[model samples]
Target: MASKNRKPPRVGDQPGFRRALIAAVLVVTAIFIVAPLVVIGVQAFSQGWAVYATAIADPDTLHAILLTVTTALIAVPINTAFGVAAAWAITKFDFWGRRFLLVVIEIPFSISPIVAGVAYLFVYGLQGLFGPALQSADIKILFALPGIVLASMFVTAPFVARELIPLMQAQGRDLEEAATSLGASGWRTFFSVTLPNIRWALLYGVVLCNARVMGEFGAVSVVSGNIRGQTNTLPLHIELLYHDYQTAGAFAAASILAVLAVVTLVAKVLLERRGAGRGGRPTLAANQTVPETTT
Candidate 1:
């Protein structure tokens, strides 16, 4: 009885209510997160390994996968370039309408992708302003691969740019000025200094943007017309299969996307851990201060 009295309360102790609360939260997360993942994995292979392989290997499925990959490959690089250039201009050299440009860049995150899709359709469709000229020139923007790419670009336009804005702002222009003072060319300074400093943040944005580009449904759907083995992306193809009552095939196709999401999550975790180990976020320059780190 004396020893029990001297002992401190542990998680399993009678008075340890916090532990129980934590356990409940964790259980809730697992139910919503882990359980769904398990379901997708199981259903993906419900028809056995051989059938799952066939589902994934189907010609339409393969085409969808290729188009998705192509979209990301094109969109990611284009966005990366734009993000860097925008971040540089906004942070390094302030001009008229800087804040306004920032607001414009963030519009994508605030609005629904569906709205973006509809807006693009109106702008690029056969009845749009440029539609007549494009058709006269034998150019097809809507209901084709080019439309898919453009829609992706529209929705993912903001990611990398936004990620680098705060980072570059915090970094200030000290390094760039120093490099210039030392007679470094603009191109050299940018390649040698700015790129290295914001590499991680840039990568973080790119990974996220690419993930969205590959997974985009609504915008791509509006432009792609869901043509089987042609404009159909992975998400659309999955829907096509599901609509045809091919549950197994649909789930199998979905598994690839699920795996990609998991991989992206893991990469984000690694980047976070790496940043932490390196003392985390950089100090905001004297001109500006970084926001307080949040969980």
Candidate 2:
């Protein structure tokens, strides 16, 4: 009779089950993620510091690094501005086709990078849409820095806006409206009221954007023409080295990208913590109403 009265065990309450799940997750992560990263590091330095340094200091590798950095420098900021404006327009105002604009902003996320690259080629290649005009004007777009930058920008365009849109939507426009009512200019309201509240998300988005720009391969590859020491970015450079059987050099170059990934992850974690600590809202100072301007 007492046995009949015993209740069923709750889900996830069994210690054995929990332990098994944890063990499975750890095993998978170690094999797939951790093991590969460890192998890259080990192989990169396997040939001694001199070899690794030589690989990194190679002229082609240096140019690749510079090209990657330059692409990121150009793409990230423009995308950031575009994202901020897009989010602001989508969330802070009611207008016709607002939903359409939102969908357009998200198009890049849905489209394949390689496909975007192909599309750019059709539009900018030697025999492409504006090709003749460009040729006549002596403007080179394909197989150059500009092509690489455009590809990177296209692939990373949505990052900042995607991060900001939901957060800003949740925040609504009350503070911005209040500030505007108190004689604050549009820029003033944005800088004072909106920026502080969304800074963490903005920063998180920028980090992710920058990381993607640096590591992008498919789209850039299609557009850049893989000119050694000219248009090849780091990822392409890594591939070139591996193809040439310079395995250590490839791994060394890949290590730089891995380091960037780690830094981005760290920044993401820090920003999440900071946002959580503040409830993802502006501080009290930012909440204060703007003083009205007197004549």
- Cα-based TM-score, every candidate: 0.88, 0.90
Q: Which has the greatest TM-score?
A: 2
Choose the strongest candidate by lDDT: 2
**In model 2, what is the error at residue 99, expressed in angstroms?**
1.1
Error of 2 at 163 (Å): 0.6
Residue 65 displacement (Å), model 1: 0.4
lDDT of 1 by residue, 76-111 (tens): 999999989988888887576776677677677666
lDDT tens digits, residue span 37-117, model 2: 899999999999999999999999999999999889999999999989988987787777666666666677767889999
